[model samples]
Target: MTELLNLFIVFAKIGVCTFGGGYAMVPILERELAEKRGWAESTELLDWYAISQAMPGIIAVNVATFFGCKRRGVIGGIVATLGMVFPSFVIILAIAAVLNNFADVPQVKSAFAGIRACVVVMIITTVLRLWKTSVADRPAIAIFVPIFALSAFTGVPLALLIVASGVAGVAIGAVRQGRGK
Candidate 1:
């Protein structure tokens, strides 16, 4: 019961205060879950973040579900997801009521513009942080560079890229193992 409440509160705070979407929430999530609360290790959090991105639904919500389930169980997943989504639901509803008028307001428009800049910075920070951990060795670099280039230049579907990368990783691992044997 206490754990569930804590999960709800923590995720709710994250959802409410975060100005951008899932990518922008990464740094905050890392700070709270990995550093402050010690709910997960930094590497574990990153792994969950990657998996969440590959799965269906919103990345932040999926991450919350993964963390909650790891901490408590299925019920915790439910609680955390609800907590994360509730704020956006309420805020969007409220905004919908006055969005037409609010959209044209100079102050609101300016605030949104500032927020967009901040969100870009937050996303870049998240990318750098993840890269620090992920790009540790030659194999990782070998896989990452070409995939990045292909995705950037050709706009390959992300799912297909991920699948190809996974297959390559497995093949490389198998070759290494065979060599050792």
Candidate 2:
């Protein structure tokens, strides 16, 4: 009971404070879940983040579900997910009510522009932090380079790339195991 309440409050705070969606929430998630509460280790959180990105639905929601389940099972997952999404739901509803009125205001427009810039920075920071943790070994680098190139230059879909990478990883692991045997 107590754990569920804590999960709800923490995720609600995250959802309320973060303005730029999932990427913007990453730093806050890391700080609260890893550093402040010690709910998860930094490396584990990074791993969860990576997996969340690859999974269906929003990254933030998926991460919250993962953490919640880890901490308090299926009920916890529900509580955490609701907590993370509730704020956005309320905020969007409120915004919808007054957005038309505020849309033409120059000050509001300028503030939005500033927020967008900050969002970009937050996303870049998340990318750099993830890269440091994810691209450590030779096999990861080997897989990352070509996939990155293909995605950057060609029009390869991210889902397809991730699938291909998974296949490659499995094959490489099999080969290594065979050699050791």
Q: Scored by Cα lDDT, where does model 1 land? A: 0.85
Per-residue lDDT of candidate 1, residues 1-181 (tens digit):
9989999999999998677678678888888898798888878876786677667888888989999899999999999999999898997888898675767899998999998888788778777887878778899899989987997899687668777888988998998999999
Per-residue error for 142 in candidate 2, Å, reads 1.7
The 10 consecutive residues of candidate 2 with the worst lDDT sum are: 45-54
For each candidate in turn, the TM-score is 0.88, 0.82
| Residue-wise C-alpha lDDT for candidate 2, range 30-124, written one tens digit per residue | 77888788888767876676677678888888888998899999899889999999998987788898775766799988998898888788768
Question: CA lDDT, every prediction?
Answer: 0.85, 0.83
Best of the candidates, TM-score: 1
Give the distance in Å from residue 138's predicted Cα in candidate 1 to where it truly belongs: 1.0
Query: Among these predicted structures, which one has the highest lDDT?
Result: 1
